[model samples]
Target: MKFKHYNQQQTVLLPYSFDDLIPEQHPVRVVDYVVESINIQPLLKAYSKEGNPGYHPKMLLKVMLYAYMTNVYSSRKIELALRENINFMWLTSMTIVDHNTINRFRSNKLKDSFKEIFKQVVLMLASEGLITLKQIYTDGTKIEAQAGRYTFVWGKSIKTNKAKMLTQLEDLWNYAQSIDNDDNPDPEPTQFKEINKEVIEQTVAKIDAKLSGNEKASSKSKAKLRYIKNNFVANLEKYEQQEAILAERNSYSKTDTEATFMRMKEDHMRNGQLKPAYNTQISTENQIIVHYTIHQNPTDTKTLKPHLENFEKTFGKETLQQLKEITADAGYGSEENYDYLQEKELTAYVKYNTFDKEQDKNYQKKNKPFSKENLYYNQEEDYYVCPMGQKMHKTHQSKRTTEAGHTQSLSHYQAKNCESCPLRGQCFKAKGNRSIERNHNLERHKQRTRELLLSETGIQKRKQRTADVEPVFAQLKHNNGFRRFSLKGLEKVELEFGLMALGHNLRKKIAA
Candidate 1:
């Protein structure tokens, strides 16, 4: 018989142990080596002085990072891999860490250490000249939180409902007063500047104190008080609690109150449902994330300032001095951001809304008369000449406020005579006056940014930006399949994200 005999039971001794099974270039090796390089004594301080020994933090950190590199996110899945996968066994040295312990360490022990560990990894890359830190391509993406979409609490909804409840509370208060044979039964409704649970509780206490002082109760008065206590008081109190939850957040998910509702890219239905998610901001260089931050803001406009502040704090002012330029998309193109970049003396090639239109000659010609740039402006006189030869003289300078609370001076121009203009229909949509308000400050900043966007360096930056940061997000979301977060609060999520970034950076080092 030419066929070799094969047995079900097989036992053999190997020349080398599991340590030799993994190659030197393997990512797990990098993970282990980098994790070992980090000083985890601060993390170990949290443990009890005397107890049964637990898994070393280095072993656990290596396991978690290796799991992330392999696209295994769940703690349970990592646990299974540690027990089953040969690579995991080689990484952990055959140590079995339960899923709960892994989850605990991620949520608790590594919360503060994630930042330090991630910083160490980035600094290592910088020292190796792998990360230039000269050019930071910043961008943000929405990642779903571990909260239900339907469980949402909106600030507007709470305010509106609270107003109605206050009206009901007043009506109930009046009913109780009327039962006491008081002519002032219909008291004026309470005008509250802010309504919350504490206010409602205080109001309830006042009513109770009045009832308690005059203990001799009539049947009718008793029934009215009961109704107020059971219905009106209860509702106001409930509304107040809801208001407490709505503090500082525009909208929060009921299941995960810390998570704000944001539209996600992974929503296959594209229904534009506001799911509980976070706007994760990342600054990447050489296809590796150098810095990252988690924000509650859905728009990317407001996140840049604080993100960089954190960067400065983490890497110091000296580190920012080493940066030659910064590039971001149109979402981060606000006047404040431009001013910030200018103040920092870092060359910014950030794109604004008008940047693309300025480059398109056809668009310029098509919208010339309507567009502010093409209109004939008498800067000395502060007047604009329209397409129909109508002169709009600058009337006043007004301060315009933004959602972020930064006020800018806007020069308002009004047409001298628009009552009988031939192009009134095209020029003005209103009945009386045609007014145009321009933020000259913002416009000037935009003009400066426009020049930067069209320069040779700007053109080079635009092309480099297209290739730098986005691929890091792609690697995290598509390659690693990290679309939704399993952790709950912002701090915990930040920790996990930092770990993910660490894993990704280490993987990049290994690949390099």
Candidate 2:
């Protein structure tokens, strides 16, 4: 028994063309077709005319998009595929692009222009009836950054160090004053809270001069002063710079400063491990990712408004004007988000934190009897009737501003007396009469949301949301192994995920 025909040095008379080598209905054909149909004028303008001949942006984009669609993320692996993989060779028309060129095109040339390409593809999908932009399911998942786990800079630690330094500086200043015995004050800095390099230098000079020839000052004190002048001052500057980089974020990675430390859901050991990650918020319609935004904030609540705003910015005002429904999980159902959704005139199917608990029979029977939801509100009298039938009148009203700067008006209500009430122990655990702060607007929104979510159309939308958007993440993170980003900074990460999203849509189109 032997093989049909085999020769080590055999050469065919005519080499097989790529078109003959590739299949007719391959996914590469879909990727190539989609890339060719989208507008690339923004990408073309990113190139300069002064360079030596370069690879066409369209060709490079086709190769990169197909590479990502097939789960080949590394530039070197893509380069190898261009050399060896028939589909890649066919996609690029047999043009061999090195890894460096591929990386430069992805990182530099595509940095400012990738969104345009992504938008064009999404619009094409929308036009083809593959996805509907009128309704969207939005959700967020934390994707780990390329930064190291331990390379973290926390804002709290910076503030603590700065506070300690300020205390030490104040002690040194008092020590200098004690030794000098001069009634006149040194003219430098009295407050160390807003210290700068110049203030530090001036204060250090005055302290050093005051302690120069003073016999009362101990050598240890002198050494401490010198340490503050040399090391502490430099550290203070470093801390200030870190604080500036950490604006509005609790912690950021030193390797990738824009990546915040967030507890990811992908932990294998089940222990909550905080790693540098970006909160990737995406809007999907018909299982296709229409828009995605990378955020440094970890929680999904604060990201909704910005995510929708970014969607509007990416697609255009007309798309937002025509948007009919918005659906998200409980994490995005904040007062601010609900208000924003109402202001935009879009029907919201978002669930609040206690929406499920409100639905539970046991929870409603056992735990929610005395909850704010169960209490009877008299809009005419501006009061609430507690479980004990006591009137809780509106005592005052105030405003609350969230970290995102959205202000909410809260009405404070208090029961007249609870000392002699029979249900005092069950009513509340507080010392004084029970009181509750209520946001009327939020309560109204929650009431409307409950009606919507419990309705027929809302139930179907909720079910579709779970099926439509979640599998995209499941395919991307688990099946495709895209849990961790390959780029360092936020902008590059956005560009990389744009490629991933675009690839996902193209692959879905092929499957369709």
lDDT of 2 by residue, 1-512 (tens): 97798787999899879898778898988888887788888888888899698988989988989889999999999999999999998878888989999999999999888888888888888888997789999999999999988898999898787778778887888888877867886654667665567767878888988999888889999999879877977797788889899988899999999999999888855789899999999999999998999999998999999999998888889999899999999999889999899999999999999998877888879845688768999999899999989899999999989888889999999998899998888878899899999999999999999999999999998899999999999999999999999888999999999999988988888888
For candidate 2, the per-residue lDDT at 304 reads: 93
Q: How does model 1 fare in lDDT? A: 0.80
Backbone clash total, candidate 1: 0
- CA RMSD for every model? 3.9, 2.1
Stretches of candidate 1 exceeding 4 Å from the true structure: 3-16, 41-50, 170-228, 358-362, 388-391, 431-433
Task: Give each model a TM-score.
Answer: 0.87, 0.95
Which one wins on lDDT?
2
Q: In model 2, what is the error at residue 67, expressed in angstroms?
A: 0.4
**Top TM-score: which candidate number?**
2
User: Candidate 2 regions off by >4 Å?
Assistant: 178-195, 268-270
